[model samples]
Target chain A: MKYLDEYRDPELARRLLSRIEEIAPGDRVIRLMEICGTHTVAIFRSGLRHLLPSTIRLISGPGCPVCVTANEDIDRAIWLAKQPGVIVTTFGDLVRVPGSTSSLNVERSNGADVRIVYATIDALQIARATPDRQVVFVGIGFETTAPTVAAAVKQAAAEGLVNFSVLPVHKLLPPAMGALLEEGNLQLNGFLCPGHVSTVIGASAYEDVVNRYGISCVVAGFEPLDLLHGIYLLVECVVKGTPQVLNQYRRAVSRDGNAAARRLMDEVFEPADSTWRGLGPIPLSGLRFRNSWRRFDAGERFSMPVIQVREDPACRCGDVLRGLMEPPQCTLFRKVCNPQNPKGPCMVSGEGTCGAYYRYHTESL
Target chain B: MKQRTVQLDQGSGGRATHELVKGLFVEAFRNEFLLEMNDSALVQLNGGRIAMSTDSYVVDPVIFPGGNIGSLAVHGTVNDLAMRGARPLYLTAGFILEEGLSLETLEQVVRAMGEAARESGVLIVAGDTKVVPRGKADKLFINTAGVGVVPPGIHVAGQNARPGDAVLINGTIGDHGMAVLCKREGLAFENEIRSDSAPLHDLVRQMLEVCPRIHVLRDPTRGGVATTLNEIAQQSSVGIRLLEEALPIGEDVAGACELLGLDPLYVANEGKLLACVPADEAEELLQVMRRHPLGAKSRRIGEVTVEEPGRVFLKTRIGGHRLVDMLRGEQLPRIC
Candidate 1:
């Protein structure tokens, strides 16, 4: 905890706030977007929004990995769990994610073989443990998680485990950002890019977004100051009418993030038309295992039927994710859906905006 | 006469469990004081000072390295009192036992509680117990309430934190959390990540003996340092800045957290306490803390400030600052 505590120095943080107040003088409405779940949680958890001047608004973005996972994809994973001799391995967050009619938890209650695994290696180990069963890892999340699953798929391929495969609903984040900017629902002035994702895709991946949108993007660590500094930098950019992607989390994120991991991801996955929860299907926004690894693809191995599902009658997760609505704004937020009995994907995951708001901000509301 | 009995879930309420207090607790711990046996206890003290605290213990795998839920109940309650600069004096233990829990295990936990109370120089003179059917309780659950008397004229509370006060920690954070996590997750490792579940009131006592005007005191439990600091910040209406390097995280824990994608700052700890002291007194307090076994690795980690009220900022070793948010949702259920 040595080098870690200084960044939390309240005095320094205060000084930075003053500096920001001075730099961004007058009533200028500066809207900066932080596109990471960690950032969003930090903002709410620490009451960071109150620290900003009235003119500055921190807008939430589609940064949560769980929030973006399409319902159909969740249903597809649930479908695999129902099949005989099929074992579904996934992250803890995915278990509670609502599908069309049910979730993996519901499936588990109904006697399905669904297990939560911390790493892809765990699934590989599971496949090794139960040779008679087909272990399918529901690969979700963005680039930070994809490489590990890609590695697992490669392992399954090399081992020639006929029973092991990955249902890769893996997403690429940059493309989605572009799609969001094009839609122009909110005039996003700047971006507070995710540090962990940056650790995979590097700071440069955001360069085009800066150039195209003429907005500043700061790759920030999940730390409060890193975020505030990123916002400060963004404010500076808007004031100067100059847009660029700046790397503030230098220790972990670089211009080129973990190149070796990125290479592994590229080697395994090819662009595919993947569906997003709120955004629908964006072209080449998702990944599929390469043709060479087709044999190791769980989507191909399992006969999953195409299905359309309706959102819960009252949930406003789509609007919540789009920053169009807050948790209290949702009719079912604390009523029909809660931490104990989540009705939608937004209420399930810990990183879900609605879930965070429900647990912490409900008292204030 | 009260006899050994089973424990029931709190959800079952006052009935079904047949838990009726006989006023033994009120008699043993009080000296011509505390007359009634109402739903809550009321005590009046001489004009010195007072501190009151409540805590619950529901540790699964029930027992582990260093301690069990019994000693933990004592430690947790005592520590809460300690945070307010109060030397703990009395404690009450409440139990909710699953129907099938063994008498042997129950005795062992009680013995632990007794030993911890004895060591911390506190007494558990009050008690309650209830029994629930199978699946209603997780082996055993304990809730403890404690009261302590502060010295003549010392003011200590969450709201006392002032800007520029230094933040100090007693030893490392997250051992208890990682210990529970590894065991709960069935993660085997070469090194034993045991829980740091020991009574911290003694450490609190030592700290106060060395310096009385400690602005703020808290043991970062449950959601870890992140949540605790946020609470303190809101209460104090101030900001807390932490030096990433100043944090005392164990190497194995760092490795384990990184591997598991868990944040150590947000991980729970049972034995550690965070203190916000005068900037000048932080180093001296750390020196005093180092002399005690509980705070052998105690160091100054951060400082309180007035800049951004109710925020916890983490400055990394490499000079980049990030906001350390309190865990919004439960990280791992039943970690305690």
Candidate 2:
């Protein structure tokens, strides 16, 4: 509560809001896109958009890992989970994600040895403790989490974890971001870069987007004021005709990111073409185990690639992730895909854009 | 709602889960105030005005260390109404029942709700029950709406925390969230973790008597104190700063949060109130709160500032400053 209560000073927020108003006094319709699932959830749940000036529109992008995760990958994870003598280790969230007709949760109920873990280090520990078990780590998430999983895999190899393997579903943030721009699915002016992901990928990752797409990018922490400041910086950049990556979260994120972590990631994995949920396969958007770590790679060791399947016909998660339509516009939003009975990834993942809209958004015209 | 094979998460639409809400929950404590059969409560203000509030509870496992959803529903509803400077009065309940629930489990929940109401001196005057068919609803979902009469002299709102105002929270945070996680995850501890779920109306009433102009009274529930303070800052359009070392967190909860890669400040709490008041009234209010069981660990954590308004900043234990943002998405889904 020490470093926390002060930033929430209502008077400070007013002053900041006033400053923001003065900085962007012109009646300009600014559309700022936050390219992080975390920021989208933060902005929506806190009703930050409701409090913001109507002129500023917050558009969600391909931020959610699960949202962008391809259908084939989920089917594959499900397939691997059901494999005999294989103990699938995954985050609790993946268990409920719908994969074709069955999910890991269903597989578990029907007798799959799937264990939920908070970290890959735990998975390595499980592998170390259970020599007879083939503990496959269901690797997911973007840069922020990839390095840790990389470190875990490196440690596994260094420790000679013969029975350990990783189902590498790890993704790269920038490529997915570029895919968003390439598709022309979103109209955006500037971007609020992700903080945690930036910690691994570095602030420079957004430079490509800023240079190619002419969008101002500023890495931001998840705090309300931090977001406001990031927005203010982006608006300032747009106003001044400047386009570059700025680090608003200097404490955690650096220009070069964690060097040791990056080294581990490089040693363990390489870029490869990967499929996203809404967007089709983007070249080099995913990470896979290097040849040296092939034995620890679930894809090669388990003799399976991600199952290719069509996206659910009823789910409009694709449009939602692309920022083409609001979640309320979706046919299954509250009717068939309510949180209590989720029918899609958007309704399932806590960080999904649709879930964010449903929980915090009020359908006010 | 239709009857179906009772399976975990199944016919909440009308199987075992439905019978629990209608037969056990509705049967035991059904009342007129909740039977309006409207989308929401329609209360006619008798005096100058009435204070109304909405609270949705999704705390998972539906039960925890010292309490379950039953007591949580009672305390959470009463506390929300009390924060508006109202005499905690009546509440209406809506439940999302899951499938395959047991009869004995439903009885325990209803009985707890009754006990909580009797202790808080409030009634479950009106209510509606729905079945989601099993596997659809998580055990049960309770949404409560309450109406209270604000006293003539008492005035409280988040927008009133001015510069030179003092900020305080009841006891520690992360306790309720951690306790629930401990029980649900089957994590064993040296001592049993317990939920601090108790109605704050009595404690709030005593505090009002001492400090009638208490600017804000809020239970830091789902988003914990970090989220609650963020709400207050934005509402009051004021800046807030707090000392980190002064904030309270139970040792076990802190440990669990660290282990789970979660910040305790961002976790949920079933029963915790954050009171923001002017500096001059801080001492007396603290004394009054201390006299009550709920506020024993209550202490002044921060102050309101005119500069940098609408931000919650904290001086860390490491002698650093950072922004404390409101929790964005569900840290843990189905958690109240």
Candidate 3:
């Protein structure tokens, strides 16, 4: 409450709004991308988008882990859930994500033993309780969540729990940013980086993007005021022609991040070229269990019949993820790819760009 | 060691059944009406109209931080009767237990129910128990039916809301739902959040005494304040406009909602109530309500309007407006 209450103060928010309004209208349109799913929701929930100047456009990036998860990985997880004696556990968002043919939620209704877990440690508890059965955890998230999965694997290895394993689709942040920079279709003025992920990877992680790509980057918290302040800072950077990496959420994030979490991640997992749904395979963006920890890898433990499946061909989630198109711009956004019957992963999760846009901007679409 | 779980034979109307009905039920609820042990509770009333309501509670993880399913069942039924401007008097409980449930858990639930009934100044008159084999039922399910007497010259209904009515709530939103969710999901925060699961009948009585012209009295339970407001709006055929800044939500609850991607407006509450009254009488009623224990944090949240008949709107904190629609289903936590 201490940190949260102050950040949400209405009075402070009003002052910041006035400041943002004053800093804007230099007659130059600015395109800023908020590359975090949390920011996307905050922008909508607080009605920050309406408060900002129309000239300043905020784009949703490929930040939602579920939205960016490759189709083959989701299909594999579904197949694992349907296997005999295998109990698949995952976060709640992944339940509704459409795979090649069926989703995990459909598999669950079809009598597969699939459970939603809030954390990976719960999967270990299930495996420990049911010694005769196999517990496979679907590990997904960015650097913010990868450490916890790493810790769970290390704990499993130490306890020698042969029945517990992870089908980790964890991704890194910086490499994906690099890939987005490489695709130079949209003209972007700056970036509002992720807050929680920054606490783990640190503000220094964005230095490479700022220095090499010459883009202004600011790590922001997920409050209305935090977002307003972040946008104001980005606008100022653009107006001043100063491209630098800044830390706006200094209360939680530091320059170096959590050193111990980084150590744990480095010990249990190694970098690998993994396929992102929209971004293709970004080099060293995904985390894979090291050879010593291969026994705890669900993909290695169970033999999955290779299911070559593609996402809905009509879904422009790839374009949406790259900020090339808004969700409503897609032909299937409201008609075919709704939250109830999501045709793609972007519309399945709440943090997904399309889902957030559909929910918060109900009047527009 | 003795068998820790309840057996199917326990509900067979045999010796085990008698022990449970007497040793657990009778001992916990030591009242003369329950001691009668009849098929129906013979409650003597002074010839007046009585309000009766029934509810069933099947909350997962039956035992939570603030209360269990037993207390929740009693509170839910009592609140339902109270919404009709009635004074709750008696309650009946029927429990369906899973065979593998531990006797200790049953005792704990019964004790919590007894405590809640006593606190609400009501008596448990009659009860029933049944058990099924393993996998047939969850740990426990409770059903409660209540009877209360409506005070003379008092009327409250959802359709009573007029254009100039004021919408008021007892306290903060999303505490009960988020508390249960945190406990269920094994989420540990800096401060341990307990459910605000308290009875509001006494508060309602004080409010009615001050302003007998109260139009509507409903608890924001399952579908939360937003759904309840929408229901009231449609029933009354009047629009309701709520100020986003006027809503009372705790800092932790707000933080948790932000983390889980849930709207506090749609999250459930167990102990809070929404009352609509004429604009002039709202201040006097709120004063009386605040004097009561349960209504200290009560505030006027919105006002009924005639503009967009049968609709609800929220003025955002940043001066934007958005329509509030009925929640179609549960607000599941985001997967990421």
Model number with the top lDDT: 3
User: DockQ scores for all the models shown?
Assistant: 0.08, 0.06, 0.15
Candidate closest to the true structure, highest TM-score: 3
Fnat across every predicted model, in order = 0.00, 0.00, 0.21
lDDT by residue (B1-336, candidate 2, tens digit) is 122333443221112333344565557778653432111222447555566666667667876778888778888878877877787778888877777777687778879988999998888899888878888877888888777777787767766777888998879887887788788889876677788888888888888888888888877776678877876887688988888678888877766775676878777776788888879989888887877888899889999888777777766443335556556434655555
**What are the per-residue Cα lDDT tens digits for candidate 3 across B25-110?**
88998987566442123233686667777777777778877888888888888887788788889999998999989999999999
TM-score of chain B of 2: 0.84
lDDT for model 2 comes to 0.77
Better of 1 and 2 by lDDT: 1
In the predicted model 3, the residue pairs found to clash are: A93-B335
Each prediction's TM-score against the native? 0.68, 0.64, 0.81
Top-DockQ candidate index: 3
Residues A1-365 of candidate 3 have per-residue lDDT tens digits of 56666777778888888887788876878999999998997787777777677789999999999999999999999889888999999998898888888888878767899998988899889999999999999999999999999999888888988899999899998999889989898788899999999999999999999999999999999987789889989999988889998899998999999999999999999999999998999999999999988888888788667788867789889899999999988899878677656888888887899888766675531
Q: Write the per-residue lDDT of candidate 1 for residues A1-365, one digit (tens) a residue.
A: 34544555666777777878888858668888787887887666555676678889887778888889998888889889999989999998888888788888778877899999989999999999999999999988899999999888888878878789899888898888888888888787888899999999999999888878887888887656776777788888888888898888998988988999989999999889988888778899999978888888877787667777767656778877776777887778778887656877777777788776764453321
Model 2 docking grade: incorrect
| Worst ten in a row by lDDT for model 2 chain B | B9-18
What 10-residue stretch in candidate 1 chain B is worst by lDDT? B9-18
Model 1 alpha-carbon drift over 4 Å, by segment: A25-27, A360-365, B1-65, B68-336
Q: Cα lDDT of all candidates, in order?
A: 0.79, 0.77, 0.84
